[model samples]
Target: MTDAIRVTGLTKRFGARTVVDAVDLRVPEGRIMGFLGPNGSGKTTTIRMLCGLLTVDGGEGTVLGLDIRTAAAAIKRQAGYMTQRFSLYEDMTVGENLDFAARVQSVPGRRARVAEALDRMGLGGRRDQLAGHLSGGWKQRLALAATILHKPRLLLLDEPTAGVDPQARREFWDRIHGFAAEGMTVLVSTHYMDEAERCHAIAYIAYGKLLAAGSVAEVTAAAGLAAADVSGGDPELVRRIKALPSVETATAMGAQVHVAGADAAALAADLDRLAAEGLSWRPAPANLEDVFIHLMARRPDPAEAAR
Candidate 1:
């Protein structure tokens, strides 16, 4: 597939502080790339730069084949952005909000487009419902409908499913995958691990830095971490595992203690000793969340680095 987004050394600064440091990213056409990071970690800043909502303080790139620096207007025209918060007119009905969005974008065949968007989002029956009265799920669907009313080729979603229910988040992801199948590229920032796993690929940023980017399996494998799930372990045993030099992290997931480490042999040896003490241990694959947590822990605080 052709590249839909290709940028290198992308940087954005505010006064002396750089919110988004030199970063590189690429997303193939018709693919969904999850952007993962802690709050204030430059994920939103990078998204703004990608869609031309903010000017790049340094570096260069092309979004939807348009120069991010020189053709921001063109990029903006072809990109649909959904913010974390709902930004539609609360007083308007669902249909009205979509209609207004289409008009604002100067979309042709406004009525047909609005109807299509409504039906596509399963909001045709709720077209007359007031935006302010809709539940979080319905409101999200309406926002998504408004976003796609313009038929943008590139979609930039920033924490789009934050407050929605699990089922709503699932439905939202299904819609996102449908869009990618239709050849629309998507870049979405999210904090949910399940949502991150839904993407074709993921990019993790922290403290203004792009730390990792790859498929879930690829990222986890690249961490070179080994893990084990231990059952029937007492709380004190869990603490001992956490304090081990070979263990990078030991998290309790229900009845099992999920432990991970960079030194596979040493970690296995430690687990073996624990197993001798009565814990039932089984090898486990390191998950994306584990790798991400390890990455975050390894990186120093931005303020400390500055000092």
Candidate 2:
């Protein structure tokens, strides 16, 4: 089957810095692929390149089965891209903004489309409100409505839920899942691990490189991480474990400390040594956040390593 988005050897550079290195990805149709990374890690750059917003300095790819390099305009028309910032006119009313967007896209039955967009996002009652006065949640709803107004085959969301309230974020994700259930493909970039877990699959990019890509369980297991949850009397047992050569990360949570390492046996030995200290320890499943932190810390810096 033809993939919804496929790219090979993708690379982008800005002057002296290579923001996105050669990367390969394949996202099937009707699936939500989560793109995750830290700040300035080229997540946005990669998204732009795939969606035909920015030209790739090198590499070849197809989005929605159209040539990314040569048929950018064509591909762009079939994709919905929600930028990091709200882009609609603040002076316009909610209804006015949707109407204008429909007109610009040349969507058939402009008024009907605008009304549907407003209604679909549960903004029909607030249609008369000025775009500028809406809170972050309402603005996010408006952005999402505008993005889907064009009925594109794929949706690319760049930090779509940032700064929104928890309730609003939940509602937004529910709508996203509804879209995916209807066979609409989505590629969302987010910093929240909880949101990342909601995706069908995830790709972690750091410093322009693809660090890990797989299901939540697969990614964590592939990281070769073993975590032991410790609780009880002495908390200093965790501190002692931290000094072991095998422990890669030791983090506290409430009354428990999670000691993780790539070598399970060595980590177990370290914890065993602390068994007599009245500290209780049990092996725990490695969470996505733990694996993400481990990958980030283990990533080698070429400049520093060269020395």
- Which residue ranges in model 1 land beyond 4 Å of their true spot? 304-307
Best by TM-score: 1
**Residue range 1-307, candidate 2, lDDT tens digits:** 5588889889998987888998888888888899998888889999999888788998898899888899988877789899998989999999988888777777898888888889899999999999999999999999999999988889999999999999999999999999988878999999998999999899999888889998887898899898988887555656776788878888888788887888899889878877776778999988888888888887765445769
**Which residue pairs does candidate 2 place in steric collision?**
none
State residue 214's C-alpha deviation in candidate 1, in Å. Answer: 1.3
Write down the TM-score of every candidate.
Answer: 0.96, 0.94
Q: What is the lDDT of residue 303 in candidate 1?
A: 95
| lDDT over C-alpha atoms for residue 261 of model 1 | 86
Assess candidate 1 and give its TM-score to the true structure: 0.96
